[model samples]
Target chain A: MKLIPYLVYLLLIAMHEVIWRDVTAIHGVTINLAAFLVLAVALYKSELTVVWFGFFAGLILAAGMPDRLGWHALALSAVAFTAFHVRERINLKSPFAKFLLMLGGLFLHNVLVVLINQSGGFLYLVWHSALTGAVYTSILTLLFFAFKDGYVTVRKIRDIF
Target chain B: MTWISRLFSRHSRNLHLVAILLLSAVLIYGNNDLNRYVNRTTLFFSWPFSQVRCSIEELSGVNAENQRLQQSLVEASLRLTELDEIRRENRRLRSILEFEPEPGYSLLPARVVKVVGDKIPVSAVVINRGQEDSVLVNQTVINQEGLVGRISEVWPGGAEVQLLTHMANRVAVRVAESQEMGVVKYIASRGMILENFPIQGNIRQGDLILSSGLGGVYPARLVVGTVASVEKPEEEAFCKVLLTPAVSFSSLQEVFILRPD
Candidate 1:
């Protein structure tokens, strides 16, 4: 059901918050569940629903982090919308293509957030985010792709029967 | 329909343009203060999970004890030394606290939930006690070993205790043996410095450092650290003194926040 997906999304976001609260990974990646969820769902569903989901996730993220209000909501929606658009242009057939696209989108998201935060020491933040995002998102993108692909295939088989 | 597919493709390209515009507008106009409020609120909501994480972390320590018994014993021995030091420091703090508690001296017991690493210039430990427990800002905290640090910020169910080693932490202390005074300055290469002590003060390498009572935030005479090295120059007006913290903050898992009576 819809509730199950939302719960799973919240759990992942909570887990990310727990692990990487005040700290960034060596390469400067901060785990972002809001972006990850948007990417996962957009790959599985339609554009409009994914956009709405991203907004909700953004709301949850923004609620907790008081430093940037609508910034995240805006960033997440943009990432979801772009991913949906790209899926149609290329053959959404290959898992590698999807993974690559996710990575690219995540990199863009990180860069855009850094620019908004206007955090000093600009060079360090950008390079660190790029390296860290690629590594973390690649691992996550693989798992989500497999899960979504399997679910869709199973649904197709069930419909035929 | 095939016609529907064509129309969708045509508009999908435009969707990217609209998304970018919206994103730029939000970034330009997003309220910074609101974002900070959201962060604070998010932190409050995440408290339950951090508590769970801390409990799990504490459990791992117990599980590690059986596998690393020898290591545990060695740690225990170190703790015993630490306990003795704590007892001596407690007596010193009590004498200082006895003289006159600045204004409101409320004591509370808080357990260390988590120690965030020091990369952020703000090294903090999450304590189980919070606003509900009447833990307030500016209250002095000390372990059995020595003076820890003051409460910088507080939450409803938990609070963050900034450790003595943090870059911004400075304590006023007196040399126990020399009775000479200086402010303890944090040094990157060295642990701490007793800067501006009179050149004539006979400060040995191992002389003890105690709070001078000048800093109202910390009750005077609490053990801060010990002199590690002294820098003396004949031409200079004051000597530079280095101190090693009395409490082994790295291994500190529990501390008692002194209730000023």
Candidate 2:
């Protein structure tokens, strides 16, 4: 509903890009920015804002990464929609809930991406990727929590007025 | 208001599902198109941020490199003196052997100023040398260690040296031991592959591969690289030989553009 959260979203995206610029593993793991954006939108739960942010976030992710178009858009929109539903019913104001939801979304998004890309039954590769994705996403989710509270408090205050 | 609500709202859950499905459709469509314009536009927007990050990284890299370079320069200066003495002795021995030195083999020392452009398989290194400095197209370029590549395009103040590892380059090379001639073609997915050579001729690992004088582009006996592997698969048309290039492209700082005789 407010401009502050949108600005916060942009800042978060930039921070993610800068932080996860380098690939650490041989197979490599992406930071899943699109998934993060989806979670952020769900955390806020304004449908129009979520859709617009998700679309733009999809565009950003698609542009920076050489992956085929629409993949990120599909994934982000799916996650965002799911998150938005959860946000509507549950008290998702807690950082722990946000982290768990994001962790699950990241797991689903990466597995789906890997499955779509892999034509052959490369089980070992897929397994390794999933494991790496889990570990990396957990760490990123923890870092996301470390920064979440301050932004949430500020937004809550703005919303109360 | 009721009509608008009915048309637009439905059940929120169903609406959400439809939105996701629509997004998925859009995403699949976008990927299928694979439009270069979208990708480039994205890159353009993000370039400034990427540049800032690159500059910061480069600044730190340059500082560490400056210290190491200073130390290396001292060691290299001493090595140069020793090398001069060895070269003089070698020249004397060559004179005794009646080995006439090839004319027009003047080495012009140049420094790499920038990497102007890069594609998947092609990259051009812009050197400080130009036509003003007698740098011409097809001039054999080499570092102190071994062959780098030839000057591809010569500008008035700068020239582009197409590294030997570039996909477009192919050098006619001869095996130093067996004297077997082969064309060294740069394959994109793979490194330099020696193609269209004599099948009977055997090439072992560590065999010295050099530029053959047949091409008239690069001078003969310039060290290209050592053969890393020799794969002779039966029923295949040509031997699948891989060569590790002598010069490292990413680390190139200084090079000499040798005038082809």
Q: Give the best candidate by DockQ.
A: 2
Q: Please list the C-alpha lDDT of all candidates, in the order they appear.
A: 0.73, 0.72
**Colliding residue pairs in candidate 2:** A69-B31, A70-B27
Predicted structure 1: lDDT? 0.73
How would you encode candidate 2's per-residue C-alpha lDDT over B178-261 as one tens digit per residue?
A: 889898977778877888865567788899998897987888888888898988877876677888877777767767888745
| Tens digits of per-residue lDDT for model 1, A1-161 | 36677756855676666756435454356666667677778787877767766755665565554545466667777788888888878778888898888887777777767766776777777787754766587677787778777844666768999
What is the per-residue lDDT of model 1 for residues B1-261, given as tens digits with 9 covering 90 to 100? Answer: 998888779887466557555653554466666456555655654667778889988999978876799887889999999999999778756754554333655456678888877463335688888899888887778776688887878899988887787778888889999788889867666667888798988899999999997977878888998888988889999997878887777766666676666
Q: TM-score, each model?
A: 0.40, 0.44
Off by over 4 Å in 2: A23-30, A64-67, A88-98, A116-122, A143-161, B1-27, B30-34, B56-72, B80-261
Chain A TM-score of each candidate structure, as shown: 0.76, 0.66
CA shift of B59, model 2, Å: 4.2
lDDT of 2 at A148: 68
Best by TM-score: 2
